[model samples]
Target: MIGETFVLKGNDSNNLIKENVSNLKVYSIDSVRVKHFFTEKVDYIIEGNKLRRTKNSKIPNFDEHVVVYNDDGTFTFNSFPRNPPLTIPFQLYADYDFSDFDSIYGNLDKSFLSEKLKNKIAKREKIKIGVIGTSITAGAHTLEQFYHNSDKDSYPYLIKKAIEKLYRNEVVITNYSQNGSSIDYLGDVFPTALKDNNDLMFIEFGMNDHIYSWWKSNLPNFELTMSNSVDRFKTHGIDVIMVGFFQQNQSWDLEFINSTIEYNQSLSNVSKKYNCYFADVNKEFSKYSQPKINQDFCGDFMHHPTSFGHLLYYKTIIPAFLKEDVNDGFIYNLVN
Candidate 1:
């Protein structure tokens, strides 16, 4: 299906679609359900409001990718002929479909995370969390809702919201995040991340860490500085959770992954070194998104997540408070 031609869906029941979405520019950080779309290289014609592919096109088919929407307001694995149903977050003409947003937060090992939450629940104490990271954690590109709290959609704030919602405990957060900065610099802002004797510290500085490739050649273990920061937090009796971010690239054609994932691995090692939680949002993002539009969670077609993206972050996070009796090992993941 790589070189196969296709058509955009209209009133027809089939899922083929290709309209002049030229008017529908897609840097939308505000849409919900049908998550967001990045792009691809292709040519098409809009005839009778149902666009179809020309002689040769590169837009992958439902078989290759999984986001082909049918006219019946239901989408599946795209190639599935109703034997099974599926949903994805690719908004078309505001036909938002959040019916299956939870599918991405696949199975996460919650043992370490749940252990931390048990102490909080048993004591019913107020939770203080410290956040340090790049623009994404600082609420970049995501517009705050009118008549709502500012930066409420950001993960730090959402983390607080999720904790209170699930545990009924008071929560306080100190977010000292700087935009356009990587973990190398942003992780060093001291006194701020150390204030209030934080119960938990969330380190989120991997998106802007493209400097690691050169830093690797010029420096020691690239994550050394971040590991130091985590050590300091741990020294102060602060629990650390190295939050991982998803990358914009989906192709693993080469053995080389992007810097964020590189940092994710580094941070994963750091988490293992300290025995703490490493919330793998990167894996969650990969599970829900299409390859061609891998950066769909990112609003700027880069690294910042939309409000919905932030919500995904929250949902993926809150399961840390898993009930001991809950049989399933995952949160928000559905049986396929």
Candidate 2:
């Protein structure tokens, strides 16, 4: 039994009177015979198949007690009813569609990279590339989560490996990236990293910049930070490759969208100003509208991408480093 008693309050003119009996008195009524109770102006009406009660003052007041019985063991009151049960089915298709924005943005072409590597081999003693960014460059996922495997899966690792494979010789790659870092923080850090000679360096910083609202509006300051960082590396005879990383979940809120566009535009301006190589991963990742596909590209819903996604990054980034056309190779064929 549902262990509780609900009190009904009202006058007795139309309450508890069996038939049309006026001024009748009744101690209790069977709960099974009645469905619900309601107040009719100054009196209470006991509702069932038909209205049986008429004018009668026999209904008890608030202090009085009455007992009712029902075999069904269900209860009801004038208030709202309880909610029905719910069931949720598991979805296997989730996270199936995530894609690496780097691939989409870089518009990679492998044959072009091969040709560029051949060109570099012909022109230079050794191709030296420097990579600078946040945790992604530090090889967080490749070294930490996927440790036992080959580093060839990570974008940077893959880039380095691809270069080495093409050249069949030592490709010096200095990685100067820290976790939870920003462009402003790189001013001091990059100088030391580029102290050694570097031919190309990839720079990524939008992830940390997006977290700080103040930096978004201060475009001049952000530009200065990038300029200072790049100038330091260039002074050391290093060619700079600027990359703008994309957030997972292709959906960008207004604030992030605006900030990202602004930041990438600023980066592009700087790249052109200095004749530096640049890759726009944010624009590339925007192609996939589905979040599941986007997640597949990214590690979680942010930061880095999965192995396949990293491969896409490799496909996109390698071409830019080599200054090759992005529409003429296995990379172009695969992405299309």
Candidate 3:
């Protein structure tokens, strides 16, 4: 039995002693009594606490000891330990309907799109758009986790839907994105995929390139990668819309930050060099903080945006695709 005021003591081969004795009134056992108790099964009772065996009764070892806490405001144990505390930052977002954007953009003038470009898009038996990038661009968890429907929630899907509604379902979209891909991978695969002409294609890939060490080492190559991809597609008389993706963790390494800026600058340069449409998705998204919008809008805090986030992307890119002047003032109002 284990109880208040009673302490157990034991020693190793060196005859050293470790005791759990207290000053309070309790039964006392001498060294001989302790030795006899260990040698034989004597029912020693302890008040106010239960006794727990430290080892098998038939093969008990003195080194294996039990821990006992007394009602006298003290605890005795063979092990020494302490608990550590942890703290972390918490972020959340608000919920709002994003479908209103369809109507807003739908009401805009068709003059935004040049007559020649509009005619080419309208003449297509099946209007086509291509998407290329990393995991988020591939629509990972964007549809199932947030939108609940794969076809209705992805940014690419939303863009396709908006195009269909505007053109009365005359559009076809092809998504050729994959997880963990960079500009190098896209440069290799995009040419064959879009050998046939497309009305427009959206390109996003800075997240992977910025974070991976290999991509950081070959940062200068990003410019060539962007130039080749855009030039290859434009050769077929297809229009290109290059997007600069946003990154969530701003406190990441400076190298990553520099690379992201470099890649986005490269994207802008390429878009200009080839006279293609360019959207600064990263800059547009940075306008609103985590408190202003829901976290679901930006999934995994790394890549992918929620439906509302997608709406943000659409709001930013659609105007550019239509050739509308998207200065900071106009974009600021659209996001708010």
Per-residue lDDT of 178-246 in model 3, one digit per residue for the tens? 777877887677665677466677788777777656765666787787888777776666667777776
RMSD (Å) of each candidate, 1 decimal: 12.8, 24.6, 22.8
My TM-score estimates for the predictions, one after another, are: 0.61, 0.57, 0.58
Best by TM-score: 1
Comparing 2 with 3 on lDDT, the higher-scoring candidate is: 3
Q: Which whole-number lDDT from 0 to 100 does residue 128 have in model 2?
A: 73
| Model 2 lDDT at residue 90 | 8
Clashes of each: 9, 13, 4
Residues 1-336 of candidate 1: C-alpha lDDT, one tens digit per residue: 000112232222222122222332222223332333324224344432244333453322233223334475433222235212121222222121122112333222444544454587557788888787778777764545321435666877866764566568898888777777776664467676665677787888666564433634423445788778888877777777787887653332211255556667887888888887777787767754443233334444345676556655665555555453232213322210
Better of 1 and 3 by TM-score: 1
**Per-residue accuracy of model 2 over 1-336 as CA lDDT, tens digit each:** 000111223332211111222322222222132212233323335442112223453333432322122354322211122111000000000111112212222322332223444466656457777677887666554323344433444566666665555445467777777777877777766657666666667787766676544755777887888987787776666666787776543232312446767777888888777766667676555654434333334433334555445554565466654434433233423322
TM-score of model 2 (CA atoms): 0.57
